[model samples]
Target: MKKTEKIITNKIKINDRFWGRYLEVVRNHVIPYQWDALNDCLPDASPSHAIENFRIAAGESSDDYYGMVFQDSDLAKWLEAVSYSLENEPNPELEKIADEVIALFGRAQGEDGYLNTYYMVKEPNNRWTNIRDNHELYCAGHLIEAAVAYYQATGKKQFLDIMCKYADYIDSVFGPEEDKLKGYPGHQEIELALVKLYDVTGKEKYLDLSKYFIDERGKQPHYFDIEKKKRNDTKPFWFNDDYAYHQAHKSVREQKEAVGHAVRATYMYTAMTDLAVKTKDESLKKACEELWNNVTQKQMYITGGIGSMEFGEAFSFNYDLPNDLSYTETCASIALVFWANRMLQLDANNKYADVMELALYNGTISGMDLDGKKFFYVNPLEVQPEACEKRKDKKHVKSVRQKWFGCACCPPNLARLIASIGHYIYSQKEKEVFVHLYMGNETTVQIANNNVKLTQQTNYPWDGNVSMIVTPEREESFTVAFRIPGWAKGTVMKLNGEIIDHIPLIKNGYVYINRKWQENDHIELSFPMVVERIQSNPQVRHNVGKVALQRGPVVYCLEQVDNGENLHGLILPRNAELKANYNPDLLEGVVSITGDAERIDQTNWNDSLYRPVEDKTTSVQMKAIPYYAWCNRESGEMIVWVNEKR
Candidate 1:
């Protein structure tokens, strides 16, 4: 059986140069800042009203509910982040606050295990009536996730039991049975959350409920259609009764192409993959693989972002990625990571981890500012301040990150993901320990009757020199697999100080070192980090003549501040000498790539918007920063794919 269990965040002690800072920022800055925002106390930030709704639902206040239907998720997600932070580093005060909130949740929950603030506060009798457009199940999913995290971190069953009661109530309400509602979430999240609940409590019913939701989605007559007909009222549903936009146009097994809201699609696919792996269902597994390939090979941007168009925040078509008009929501990119990580658990494929790394380093990190306070809900590859200001359609493309969002999903989502990033670094099977991602960390793994202590040191995603030390309680024979990233070529692994003469075993982009180890045995792996030019497929019309820069896993982009405005006019020379330089003062000390390029003197053409091709150009020195590090400095145009001299 493949390894389905991943190492938890608490086990891996991160002390690295790059990712450690990010995690620390989440712990110290983002969490507190978001806590204030959730309480509607953050200065100059959009009001969340997340806490006020709970107070109203709990009968602590008579004030009406405010914000969207899914406002509760902001607090739920924040609780999840708090749980992870508890595991990373215990905060008694924070835990006390979380406990108080959980108590409020218990108070707000109805007599029948229902726990939605909007319905409880205003329309108590009309609960679960509009699951298609409303986000009841979606909010419940976040609550369940928080419950599981809190249970795992603090070993407290208060929140877990509250959510489980809600889940059991949900199970009683909807299913394939004749008396059940036969309904699922329009925004697909509870499906995956149920799987997590089952994993934690060993409860078969939660797993069965998740399977029922997946199996019922997009089935004949369409549950959403039936529900809508029953209501017979029009209130402008977000998807406009279009099943494709929510990925409910067809059954899970029949749907092949990636479609719908990117976040919803990825979250549903994650649950599907989890169920498939747990049940050993080959057909369902194949469906996940098909969708995975469709997204990564055809629909995904070079920065590992999805949701190409702004209209629906959805997948448009194959090779239809646009640079400027993109709606790559940070939540969508995070959902992509969730799905890819689950796929890795099922198949142990490097392709999935590659996408995970791409999304983590670029799309996910770019959602937040360097200061960890401001956030970008939509990440665009190309940006022009003028276009953002003047074009009504491009208004979502902000030159700077915002203080808060009305929806307010991405910031908290980023917080939880970053706080729990250690969970994605490693996994374990029967006798093998898999190293999925590299960073400075110390971890202990239990293999059968033995405890193994392993420590790793590296500056990854920037440099590729990793040194690992293995110390088991006793001499034990087990396999330790280190992932040789797909982007890495000419990788070398050495046992102790000398290179082993024996041919190393390689599987799924990992080199397996299985041996009976002593207390202080050492392993070193090196992958040369070189700046490589990446070009899109010829089918991708927008990027046919352009190239993106990549060093290791970090994608680099050209900013107008370094190359002057009108970034589209800048072109890379055929023999451009690109070099990486570590600048301590810029964007918190990133390794910026410097090179020489040419620019057309288009300023001379004062009156002509279009003219005959002229061979007039000027040589210019250009600098490129990590895609995640862009937009941190002065607002200017940015381009990941630069025009290359033919």
Candidate 2:
């Protein structure tokens, strides 16, 4: 089995106008603010006390354990983000702080290598007793990931050694062995983290354990059911015994559709893809492909958001996406990106990179505000402040970003993703270098026993032009593959000021340029940027007669601050001349889409419940901002799909 190579985060330097600002925010603002939140230092925000739980479990603090069962994972994720941020740009103070946190982990871990502050401080006697509800393995998975990332960033093995001990302990407790308990994580994260641990330490046991967890899930006499019987508890299951909620209804290979909690489903799929690549498991690879198709085609939002309903924070049936009541959790989309990257590694196909870019530019970043302090847990396509406040169904939706939430998973997730954005841009396999995303950055890749330095300059998502400068250490033969986005058309490429008119070289959504003897080669690509109106399939009942605006990779939305009240009443004419204008003064310099539309004049309705069919309308100019930038300025209603006038 041939495995794909990943570029270390420290090797790539991002300097784009768009992502560069986000990276700065993650380093300067989000990381520090989250550090404070973890310590319970934010006076105006909800208490995190995640750090305190570790202290209390370590006998360094007297406070009782507080917060959710999965609170410890919050610190784990934050530390992971800190690892990436430090790799991108070194900071001594932040490194010191992260070092202190690692020392805390050392003290909190038990003699038998058991960790998890919630169980240590509160439920020591009941450790691993309730893997069905509690996120014990989930927290361990995140801590292991942070440990791997920190070790990769700083070459420090303190945290890595700690997690290795905990992982070894876990391996002893659960497996196919007769004495070990036959249980897996209800949350489906450790499987992927184990793959990372294996990658770092070359420990075959970690790889085998990850495969064991994936293979054991949803088997006969399900583990959750067995555990429930062992505990001998009469209480009903929290999710009403719907095994699908935990994605345990059927074996992984037999399961066709994407189901269960959105984050868990995506995370598990990511790990499955990883194992498939590492072990050459054909059936597992096929299952991943089917699930990937179902997710990106039938059940995904236009903004690359998944998990349609808030009931279980899970995916509904096909084409059941409702904009206003959608629970497109930020973490789910980030996890989708994770899964997409793994799929790309499995095969350098454009299909995976397209969705990865979609989520990165729209759904994922929409979870955080421009300033990086406020965050959104549920990213609704359409929001009304009054409906969010008054309606029962829309209660999960928020019209504005909050300081912090009690659950507090999405914020740190976003921070780490943005901090590690460089990892998604490029991938390599042997002599082939694949450019998955067109971000402005520079990196060096060893191809054919020669060092190749590649630099990219682009104002992507706002402009469609990209320029690349490739410099190899000596005359070497290699291939450079650049992704031609699915949304782009009439793409023109130039090699050293000469047009490459051959179209046969483009395959699988990428244009391949193979040659030898390069010292200062230059490549230019142009993809004409235009405002386009997109319509959903008729099966999507909510968006049947509506159209969404998109320019480049950025999806646009209508906010009441720009459109006015009753955004639903606005109708965009099919023939309206949509124009894209770069507004440097608005929404942190975004390309806003403006067009002509009609509004239903309800001024003289006089409180009538029903009125005669009158086509009384007024001409109005509508302005749509990038979906990610909405709610950053004003508090009002926002809608992505507007009524279309046929």
Residue 373: error of model 2 in Å? 0.8
Tell me the lDDT of model 1 at 488.
89
Tell how far residue 211 is off in model 1, in angstroms: 0.3
lDDT of 2 by residue, 358-411 (tens): 999999999999999999999999999999999999999999999999999999
Candidate 1 per-residue lDDT, tens place, 1-646, comes to: 3446555455678898898899889989999999999989988878999988999988899887899899999999999999998888889998999999999999989888999998888787788788987899999999999999999999999999999999999999998789999899989999999999998988989999999999988898988878887888655556665788878889999989998889999999999999998888888899999999999999999888999988888899999999999999999999999998899878777888889999999999999998899999999999999999999999888988999998999999999998888889888878888888888999888887898898999988677899999999999999988888888888888898988633348877878888998897999989889999999999999998899999999999988888899899999986899999888788888899988889988777879889888889999898999999888879899889999997
Query: Can you give the TM-score per candidate against the true fold?
Result: 0.98, 0.99
lDDT of 1 at 157: 99
Per-residue lDDT of 272 in model 2: 97
Q: Model 1 Cα displacement at 438 (Å)?
A: 0.5
Residue 112 lDDT, candidate 1, scale 0-100: 88
The local lDDT score (0 to 100) that residue 156 gets in candidate 1 is 99
Model 1 has an lDDT value of 0.89
- Return the top candidate by TM-score: 2
